[model samples]
Target chain A: MKTFPILLKTELKLSLRGMDMLIFALCMPVVMVLILGAVFGDRPAYDGASHTFLAQSFGAVSAIAICAGGVMGLPLVLSDYRGKKILKRFWVTPTSPAMLIAVQLTIYALYAFASLALVSLTATLLFGMRLAGSPIAFLGAYLLVMVSMFSIGALVGGLARDGKMAGALASILYFPMLVFSGATLPYEVMPPLMQRIADALPLTQGIKLLKAASLGLPAEGVALPIAVMAILALVCGGVALRFFRWE
Target chain B: MEYIVEAQGLRKTYGAVQALRGVSLRVQRGEVVGVLGANGAGKSTLIECILGVRKPDAGEIRLLGMHPERERKRLFAQVGVQFQQSAVQERIRVGELCQMTAALYPQTTPAAPLLAQFGLAGKLRQQVSDLSGGERQKLFIVLALLPMPQLVFLDELTTGLDARARRDVWQCLKQQKAQGLTIVLTSHFMDEVEALCDRVLILRHGQTHFEGTVQQAVAATPHQRLEDAYLWLTDDEREDNA
Candidate 1:
């Protein structure tokens, strides 16, 4: 644990040099909020909806970084390290591989939070957006979704056996969630059939939970999303732990 | 005799193939040991088992008077390793890699001087991937020694180096050996073995075929040079195994 801070600082530098997550995870969500505000400025989402289009999207758009970083960035790094035998090299040192992994997780979480703050600030300052939900509840919901997405990433990274397969799996999980999970596209606007399909994606459940929290909707409706996210976290995190390999 | 490494009756099988069978060797403190073998001769498997990266089916092994698996964290602190295929995280700056490595050991020598000794003096901010193969190879050796370890394991230490770079590395290693550092290295380069190793253990088909000093190996075979001696010794085993 004493080595963690240095590891984190170094890993953070590596991530910044790698740059994919910076563009997608740190900067993309803010860009998305600006796009949302510009495209549908101050206009109500639908005829009788209380929220404007940007306001309606505030919660889901905030999760773009999580879906990007947690689902794509985390596993890609894991598989790359595993494939290159970097993980094995690190293992040859006094540091445990778990320490390296924990540092990576912390880096992604830091990026996610930074993205969230930027997205929220953009929406509020540029387009007069405000969170209607309780601040504490909103934070809780955000973290739950982040965990769910990150666990799925871990499972793919642990089980894929190599970098190529992990990259393929990450793309398979990333694109559909980014496109159809109400993160990049609005959930309320999708056709019912499309909605049903999106609901099967974990991020869809996540966005649903986030949307409810952002809108200050009734808590009664969120039980299913909560259960889905929790179960996904437990199962995926457990399986990842069970099968994770250093070499 | 203060053996730094001791392995007895090591055996390992992979499915239908036996990679190591009853292989044993020992190294004393301050001695440089070389392991030489052809492509599929189980040198890697033996080394992996010795390093606790892979477990042997049957063996008792000790390094620095500690079990590799039982006291890994503590053992690793005093031992450095440079694997044949270990390319670290891409795009990581050399200085950062050194910093990250230096942080893991309880005691470490400064990396700048080590890097300088390997011709990478001012390349700290340079990314590792940007280095040439030989440069990367030298960087790894530099990293291995940064821990100021009592012993270091190097596989294919001079594979990518040019003649000058190889000589420079050999000279640097000679200096390390002079400073009471013990080394265990595997190399196909017999000249490297003859230059750096106080003793050589030749493995064939997962078993020790010869164990002796470089001069003894040449004396056993009717060859003038260590390389020719090595080739002549393993040639018969190749035919038998075939």
Candidate 2:
């Protein structure tokens, strides 16, 4: 539709102006890649593991952007617009306010893909990190993980009554996963109890799925994580669609 | 003459409080009609119902000759609106918001000239959050006119503007009415009603208490000024006589 491109461009400009996502979604992943490369360059992931620490963590660190954009960037933007009645303004126009949501999703996707590229480039160039799996497989898995993570945000954004509620919900989802899901701090370094706590997180499942695909390891051990991501995507995405409000 | 808007027997209730009690009015093409009301008198509820932003509990309404509820998506293309609580994206520049609003319509007036008309010519790069209240009000008015709409609905159109800015906006809207744009607006300023509205509808207790020319409304009361007449009509002491 004619409205789509204009809305997308406007949203992109607004996001760039805000610079919140740029720092968290775009810059953070690259920073994590750098930190991983510096701290554990050339070290194997664990005894008898097929990939080095940087290579293994590459998959996990790449998900940093996904977590940030999906949990924080997407919901914050949605709830802010709704709370301010910007969504109501668009609703009175010929265009549907769903276009706003679509544009936002597109922007986050752009951020996620750009973040992925930056993370991959930094890891590959700096620490000689390489993806061991099929490039196509990694791409598919990356998108799946991203979408699944975003589904959580969609539900929170759709159902939240206001910005404050959405912020509280997004933070609850974002922090534990960022710290213990192996997206930032190494999953191997967390205490067993903490790992168990992280395992309950949906993003933890996303990181596990990405980890298997990027390492080119057998995905056989990852069936649960894959199912978890797919189910979360379907369920949360369905609930969001059912309940999403324009204002 | 063809009516650009028509509504009858509209009723809406929020819990036990009746917001609209069978209110109705119609606007002919090229006429500027003002809805005058005290607080909680259902002026906004009526507008929102007609525009399909809120559904009436019971009513028949048409906007732009189309059923507002069923054909809202198609009907809204021809109507421009400015709400009192309007807040655009805080981080967006003035020009960007205008461009975005323009993009939503099939036909549009150039944003620069509209911005210039509102004394916002040099504010293209300024963020919306940084604008003064009057500037923001003017900006929204500019946006409401951006689509070159055949009909415009503005609620509390001059609420925050100073006398000069209000007069400037009145002059601009008068030109638009001269160009055959129909307008339905609500205002507390009788001077604004006198300047722009050809007729006025006064609301009391969620019902259409009076509908006629400004002169007719004024003649109904002993007061010479429109504001005094408004106060007289809406005064609680006069309720028993009416």
Candidate 3:
């Protein structure tokens, strides 16, 4: 539709002006890569793996941007729009609310990919960190992680009555996922009981899949991760659609 | 008679409180109809139902000879609305907001001329959050008119405006009326109603209590002034209900 591009362009412009989230989502992962790669250069992973620490952790670190944007930034913006009646204004126009939601999702997806590229390129060029996994498999797993994480955001934004509630819910999910899901804290260093707790989190499975693909190892026991991410994407995405409020 | 809007026995309830109780009215084509009401009189609720923003619990409503619920896309394409509490994103620029809105409709008035007409030519690149309230109101008017709609709804369009800014907005509405645009407005200012409305509808306790010209409204009450007449009508309704 003609209106999609117009909405996308305007939305992107507005997003660029408020660069706080953009910086966090796009730059934070690359920053993490630089810091971690420097501090632990060429050191073996604590899991007794042959690859350097950076190579094993790069896939998980790349997912930090998606978690930030999808869980926190997306819901906050959407709920703020609804609270201010921006969506209500659009509801009376020829453009449906679904179109606006689609545009927002596309924008976040672009951020996710851009963050991935920046982190990958920086790690490869600076630290000789290479992804040993199949590129196609890595990409597929990355997309599944994005969809699953973003669906949680859609549910929060769609159901939250105001911005305050959305922010509260997003923070509750965002911080724990960032720390426990091997994004901020390396999974290999955690104790056995901590690993079990981390594994219970939805994002941990995604990290495992990414780690396997990035290490070029056999994607053994991938069925469970795939099923969990798929079910989460379906359930959250379905509920969000069902209860989506335009205003 | 061709009615651009028609509603019969419309009712809405929010929990135990009734917002609209069997309210109904009709607007003929090309008429500037002013809706006046007290704070809790269901003026916004009625407008929302008619615009298909909310569904009425019990009523049949039509806009531009089409059912609002069944033909919402078509109805929205032909109607423009400015709400009392709705806005674009705060960071969007004036020109960008106008362009985005224009892209939604099949036809549009040029954004540049419309912005200039609303005295926003210099504010084209200004962020919406930076504009004063009156300027934001004017920008909303520009957006509402960009669609070149057949019917426009403005709810409390001049609530917070100063006298001069209010008049400027009124001047823009007068020009639109001159171009044969039908407008449905809600306001507390009797002078505004007298200056622009061809007919007036007043609501009390969620029902239509008076429907006529300003002159008829004045003539019906012991007081001849439009403001006094409005007060008398509302007080009369309160007394009757008591």
Per-residue lDDT of candidate 1, residues A1-247 (tens digit):
4588998999998889888988998787888888888899999989998988888898888898998888899998898888888788776788878888888899999999998899888899989998888889999999999998899998888778888899999999999999999998899889999999999999988988998999899999999999999999999999999999777
Query: Which lDDT tens digits does candidate 1 get at residues B14-120?
Result: 99899999999899999999999998899989889999999999999999999998899999999999999777877789999999989888889999889887789
Tens-digit per-residue lDDT, B1-242, candidate 3: 99998988889999998999998879988899999989989999999998888999999998899887688788888899999956678688888988888988878889899888888998888888898878889898888988889999999999988998889889989998999999999999998998999898899888888999889999998997889999988896567787
Which residue pairs of candidate 2 clash? none
**Candidate 2 chain B weakest lDDT stretch, 10 residues:** B68-77
**Candidate 2 residues B11-61, lDDT tens each?**
999999899999988999999999999989999899999888898999999
Note the B-chain TM-score for every model. 0.96, 0.95, 0.95
Quote the lDDT for B189 in model 2: 95
Interface RMSD of 1: 1.3
In Å, residue B176's CA in model 2 sits off its true spot by 1.6
Model 3 per-residue lDDT tens digits across residues A3-37? 99998999888887889567887878888898998
Q: Which candidate is the best by lDDT?
A: 1
Candidate 1, true inter-chain contacts retained: 0.76
Which consecutive 10 residues in model 2 chain A have the weakest lDDT in total?
A210-219
What value does the lDDT take at residue B34 in candidate 1?
97
The top-ranked prediction according to DockQ is 2
Q: Would you list the rank order by DockQ, best first?
A: 2, 3, 1
For model 1, which pairs clash? none
